[model samples]
Target: MEGTSFLKEPVGGKSVVGKIVDNITNAIINGELKPGDKIPTEGELSEAMGVGRNSVREAIKILEAYGVVHIKRAEGTFVSQEYDSKMLYPILYGIILQKDSTNQIVDLRKVIDVGILHLAVAKLAAQEMPAHRLSRIEEALERLKVEILSPEPQVKNVHDADVAFHMAIVDLTGNTMLQGICNYVDKITRRSRMMAMDQIISEGAVEKFLEMHQKLADLLKTCDSSQISQIVEEHYQYWANVKE
Candidate 1:
């Protein structure tokens, strides 16, 4: 940890604790602190960064919440071993707080989903995909079918199934980063999906929604890139229509 004194004094506007968090996060991102490395003690950080111990402690807590670091009771705080889905919370929270219109959010989701489908279809078309690999998508679609067609389909159940179906398609792309980004976007749009589902149920069009999802599943199996974009557009069109 030699020569690691890169944190600067707090600047204007931002709180000292927030600045401390930023500095520590920057250190991690800059490769100064690798995973599993213990961070400087609060006393050391406070003195070096010209911040109070309380600020250092608060910064550590923020980092922990973001999955950027982990605290070992009685031991020092260390960088997280694996930055997993927990890291998506901050980004998801940001999206949730944004003032984007419902239609705009739906449009963004549509674009991401369509792009993911294109990549997945391309991959399937270029290679002989294993049946096992595609099984999850089929399973998800089956769950969705069951949920939507149930005698009394609950909105929450339908929404979860719907997310699983689309997430299955994202998984087919075999791109971790894409999957993560899609997961965040998909999570934030759950409310919109619920709203759309409610509208469909009220309109007595749940059967139509079921048919569209079933068709999308069928189209995915074909790996026909030429037709996927159009079908994907139609699938999302339902949401746009509902929004309008």
Candidate 2:
């Protein structure tokens, strides 16, 4: 924290809290600060930046909420060292706020889902995967099938099962970055996704919906990467039709 004279730079343009957030984030981006580095105390930042303590406190709160920084009860704040899903909230909100983002969200999801499916298929074809991992993928598919075929399937149950089924395939890739990004897109579109599931079920298309997931699960064993896009397009058809 001693060499952070950059924090003392005069603020201009944005609101006081926004400037503080940007300065600290810029410091991190430029390698002036690093993960796990302790941020200067609120009093120290206020004095350096000529801002009120309240502004610094608000900035710190925002940073902590976004998973950019971690605050200990008495040990002060430090840059986050590990992945936190909260870090994706800003992008999620930005995507949500955009006009006509449903198709965009559907497109975004289709791209990742297709990529993940291709990667998983390639990985499965290339490796002698552990029995447990293979079982997990099958188990997820079975759970979805069960929920969809239930005597009186609950919309929430079917929706969660559907998400879990794709996530299981995503997990097969063993790529943390892919998993993170996939989960972020999944979260941003959850409300629309749930509504889509309700529509599918209400239309008595439960078998058709379950069949699509079954085909996706089957593709893991049979379909080559070259054949992923079409299946993914069919998979996301309902999602794409959902209104924003």
Candidate 3:
């Protein structure tokens, strides 16, 4: 594939406007451009794209209208949430912007994730998922338990474990949209999480967080989607308590 930031053309029919919109959008969609990362200044993008600053500005305006980015007064520009299929754009914007805690996000995650996993499970067979998935989920859960219990947990591990847990679910769903949204949220909010959580991870707390993981595995093992939602919510509530 072409670099994530570059658009693919039919080898000869590429247009300049098409390429600029295509490349910038590709960068954002492919994680080359990220949520908190500022877009290149108008002057910079003009130079880089070999287009006039007016063209760059127009493209940015179009992207803003698409709900793909937001421009702050002095903080420059940032990416928005990956487009949502379930929630309206305004609602998703509120949830992302007004959230004061990763715990709050965890709360939203639990509620929204419940619906997603329900749809995902519908895509799978009743017999069971695969053994590899059970192992991946369990391993991801184990890593999370370690992060929660370790006296001096690194933030990187927690981020990886967290991503692993959710990505594992994306795997279960086998849906690109599910994975895309997960990646989208991760990109958009990851910086705030990194900053806010740096001091909180090792703030002297320990507990059996893995029980929920065990419960989820149990539900999956028996092909029971009924309890999976509760298990997911129960697991995330621990993090939600960080604000309490």
Which model scores highest in TM-score?
2
lDDT of 1 by residue, 1-244 (tens): 4668555535346998888887888888889888999988998898887778888888888889888999999998999987477787776676667775566667677778778878877787777455466788889888988887788989899889888888888888888877887787776677777888878877888777877777767766787667666776777765676652
Residue range 1-244, candidate 2, lDDT tens digits: 5789669777779899999999998999889889999988999999989999999999999999999999989999999998887887887788778889888878888888888888788778878444367677789888988988889988889888888888888888898877888888877778999999989988988888877877787777774677688888998888888875
Query: What is the lDDT of every predicted structure here?
Result: 0.78, 0.84, 0.64
Query: Which pairs clash in model 2?
Result: none
**Candidates sorted on lDDT, descending:** 2, 1, 3
| Per-model TM against the reference | 0.82, 0.87, 0.52
The candidate with the higher TM-score, 1 or 2, is 2
On lDDT, the candidate that comes out on top is 2
| Number of colliding residue pairs in model 2 | 0
Clash counts per candidate, in order, are 0, 0, 0
What is candidate 3's lDDT per residue for 1-244, written digit by digit as tens? 2243343322124755556666777787678878666676777676655677776677777677766777998777677766534324444566677747455666666776787667656655553555466577777778888885677677777776767777787778666666766665666567655543454454543343455556765665565687866677666554555532
